[model samples]
Target chain A: MTPPSRFDEPWQAQLFALTVAMSEAGHFTWARWAEAFGATLKAMGTDRLLDGGADYYAAWLTTLEGLLDRSGHAPVDEAAATKAAWERAYLATPHGQPVQLPG
Target chain B: MRRPFGRCILDSGFGAPHDAPMPHDHPDHPHSLLPSDPALRVKALETILVRKGLVDPAAMDEILDTYERKVGPHLGAKVVARAWSDPAFRDRLLADATAAIAELGISGRQGEHVVAVENTPDTHNMVVCTLCSCYPWPLLGIPPAWYKSDAYRARAVREPRKVLAEFGVSLPDGQKVRVWDSTAEVRYLVVPMRPEGSEGLDEAALSDLVSRDSMIGTGLAGASK
Candidate 1:
């Protein structure tokens, strides 16, 4: 099906596509992804009920990060540092213009 | 958009009962990968994946940009416009969307089983996937985050009018609303009612006025945006 353009936002679509691309390339198996994601959902636990409207893609990312940690695959602190840089870029970038990571 | 995680999130951090313990070790604030903004967060993830060689940055840009800038509602718009101009094609679409769409040479994932619902003056249709984010990816590309959200999935069914209204799709009280929930196996595509004065326009021209949300029944086609 055409993914619907129904993604609540652009990030959701981007992330969804990213996961598919990574999986297709055999970087991670669907089973591995499901386990990690399922664990993350379980972590949300009883509180998942309280966080009434959590974004799935967000949870998916958390699962990916957590899985990477388990597998020892991330570029030591690269994910953390990239996130920080994005936060900084978002702050620096003006509204309506796309944010770019600076060199 | 943040409905608290009940007691899971303490006044301080995760699993902190009494004093809101903020561990601050890349603490997961929300929105999965944090960074708050979706675009920025996506960028961050993309950067890391590229560095790891799991994803080629150039190809990654192309894949994302294809859906973001290139592919979109326009493709669906053409299908819609052709249906408007040709009743036979519309009938084929309604009867066997896959075959009809295939007639136009459009085929891909997420649209393996497409069910086209036409919007008439008396009735309107909308699409959703309450179970999961099962969208007609081949026709619409990527779905919006709201389409995948828990709130939208619930509200789209329970209070469709309210949901449509929020989407700026206020319908007449007389028109009955039919909501279609897309599944992994079957996908629903809404063929919106064509606007008047669009009569003289060709299929391509008619396609120009079609927006992405219109196919999902959240917006109207041919209306000035």
Candidate 2:
């Protein structure tokens, strides 16, 4: 039988892919990623019960943000601003219209 | 119109040539942006990296395909089947799991170092990564949701018998349960004993009986019909 989807959603798999790709490209070692991920899991704590790995992926995103910040690749503020820009651009688009950022 | 380069204008530390300008910066045509959500955040990250030349979308697609399709438990089942049918291979697997697994052209990431613990009539083995969801992705695809759950990670080591019982695996009083804690450097794959009445089966047929849970030590191989 086919195994269940490894990731709950498409974004989770995308994040997983990006992280592994970047690491493989020599941006950072896999060990470093594992270490930060483990540390992130610890800081996330075990207070809440399982929520189908939402919390786990949240921690993964947080760890990626930190790694990017430390590597001087993409500062946290830059990523946040980019996300905000996308948020605004999409909001400005009309219903049934494609969203495009101002050039 | 997408700018070839020199859009973000930052010297990415990687020193690789930039792939393209940010997806949103140019907007030559009307492109739909996903609603502002968690997925959009990931898209935003991808956009930034693409602009910086740290990663490209094609590479991301390839990596995603590798994990999603090419790698998984069936590979591990093949190894388990070989170990069961060939005594010499079994000894080599127990003696040096990493090399033996690599012999089957399966070695990468979390599976770089593997230890194949044998489950005998006396001892049972289970694997857990208490730190996070560190799993042998190259062997057993992605871990099940429960493996990454807090309850399993916290309780598996402390109460293996109880957890096994919940999985419908009740052991005899004389059987010893051994829980192996997986780490980034090393992972454990349980080599469950071949089921009885499966002696005449070939490796290909025997592999059909190796469930993902059986390799993880949560369940046993199905009895041969």
Candidate 3:
């Protein structure tokens, strides 16, 4: 698939960036995710969360953020920053119109 | 808050039976003769909360308005677009939808194990979450208010063709209507066929042809004339 447009809407851009960042950091790998999530569930005693699977994935995303932070490739904060930038751009643009991608 | 109850009492005329035909028996009426109007009921509940100083009226209106506009169609269009543009991808979507959809970079909370079923000349497909509104969020986004209603869920599967007809979608008599029951484990999206005269359209144009109801299998994609 073609690279996601830089001008993608806030949610679209965030999704694109998260996918790319996680893939690059190897956090998207099922093995890594399963291990991290399993460990988190074990530590947190799964009972604390309402939906076991949802909670596991939420914990997995948290773990991924931390891992990306430690690796220094692209810090977790950078993800939030990117998302915020997109959100601001989206708010500024009119509704029902596609955001123009930068060349 | 008080108006609906007053109206209900006025309409009911203090339990006096009238000669006016019941709504359920009326051929033109789209909905059943249920005593309660869901929207009005919700408004009544919110009015109570507002009266008790729990939630502000403006806040409630804003929340409801945002939900009505933003959340559902955005995701539904994307799924329809993807299906129209990619046949190989569509095949995979029909085969093992959950994993296939995730490949397209759209899966998360309450969205896993999605299945896309096709409607053909001989068969038509519709979906309902019997227990609750378990929708394929990765594709169709949030389930609409009507989708979450017990009236819809209970009746949809039981009278598939009838429900579809009420939605203004009638399949040919020979066509077999297959109602897929959605559960917490697996949700379904209807992969409607590309409309006629839409053969040479680009992806964006094609996406425009897909409606939220079509993706949910309540209606078909409009044919280009």
RMSD of each: 12.0, 7.1, 19.7
Q: How are the candidates ranked when ordered by TM-score, highest leading? A: 2, 1, 3
lDDT of 2 by residue, A1-103 (tens): 3444567776787788889888888898877888898888877775566543887888888899899988888887888888888767665654334444566
lDDT of 1 at B16: 18
Q: What is the Å distance of residue B166 in model 2 from its true position?
A: 0.4
lDDT tens digits by residue: candidate 1, A1-103? 2333434554555576677677657777754665566556455543643132344766776776666656666543766788788776655644323445676
Better of 1 and 3 by TM-score: 1
lDDT (Cα, tens digit) per residue for candidate 3, span B100-195 = 767767664433477788878888888886654567755665465567554576688888888988888878899998888876557788877678
TM-score of each prediction: 0.60, 0.84, 0.48
What is the lDDT, from 0 to 100, of the residue B205 in candidate 3? 79
lDDT by residue (tens digit), candidate 1, B80-193: 999999999999999999889898877753224888999999989999876556677667876766776666766889999999899878999899999998765678889999
- Who wins the lDDT comparison? 2
Model 1 DockQ, alpha carbons vs. true complex:
0.14
A36-94, model 3: which lDDT tens digit per residue?
54455455543552232333234434554554456553454555554344344334434
Worst 10 residues of 1 chain B by lDDT: B1-10
Each candidate's fnat: 0.21, 0.38, 0.00
Per-residue lDDT, model 2, residue B52, is: 92
How well is each residue in B70-181 modelled by candidate 2, as lDDT tens digits?
Answer: 8888899999999999999999999999999889998876325888999999999999988887788888888888898888988899999999999989999999999999
